[model samples]
Target: MTTTLIFTQLTIREAQRRKILWVGLLMGLVFLALFAVGFHYIVAEMDKYASLEEALTITGVLLTAGLYAVDLLVILMAVLISVAAVSGEIESHTVDVLVTKPIHRWQIILGKWLGFAILLTLYILFLAGGLMLIVY
Candidate 1:
């Protein structure tokens, strides 16, 4: 296979092997659970506050903030996953084998970056979908 393809596969495999991905997934789930509980409480309290319209307005704002928070978390995870992708390989001496091949250093770097970017995009999409389902 081409160097770029190899590098991309390696980067993705590395990210999958890391515990951080699982941790991030767990955190996202926890956040969703908390949001659900909070939403229910807000709805209950809204009955006491005044009109359902006003309560809905408040809920909408909170839900928007929650979505933004999820986006931020996904971004953070992307950066962490990408940053570690290269550094971890170097530390583990895996890069040595790849570099010894016919591949250029720049190709390796770019390939890994692309892989991480893809992973990040997938993560954000999933998180957004989950949030939308919860909000609706």
Candidate 2:
């Protein structure tokens, strides 16, 4: 219970402090714009194709590629965010204050990891949702 609370608080604080939200929003907008442009091009090309089946197949392939691209973006962001979490705090000496608390060192580390994990999970969900919106 204590660990969970600590993790939740840390995650909330990090989310409020970092540029993750803005970066995510911008990435999502860009992804949607790209998907739109890609879909338009695919549709045009499909019209040139001889068979309706071939057009649908090509469209499906393009959509799959877009979905994979979105997943890659999400994974990249997750790695970047997690990589920054502990190292950034330590570099800024923010961890020092937390270390002085009554909490154990291991608890602090675990809490931070859990916080980053939660953030990554949310980021993945957002990316997946955006991809679904674009594809469907």
**Residues 1-136, model 2: lDDT tens digits:** 5965676677668765778756865887788787887787767777886498887777678778877887787777767667776788789998798878776777777777777677667766776676666656
Error of 2 at 135 (Å): 2.1
Q: Clash totals for all models, in order?
A: 0, 0
Best by lDDT: 1
Assess candidate 2 and give its lDDT. 0.74
Residue 23 of model 1: what lDDT?
Answer: 86
- lDDT values, one for every candidate: 0.81, 0.74
In candidate 2 the C-alpha lDDT for residue 22 amounts to 66
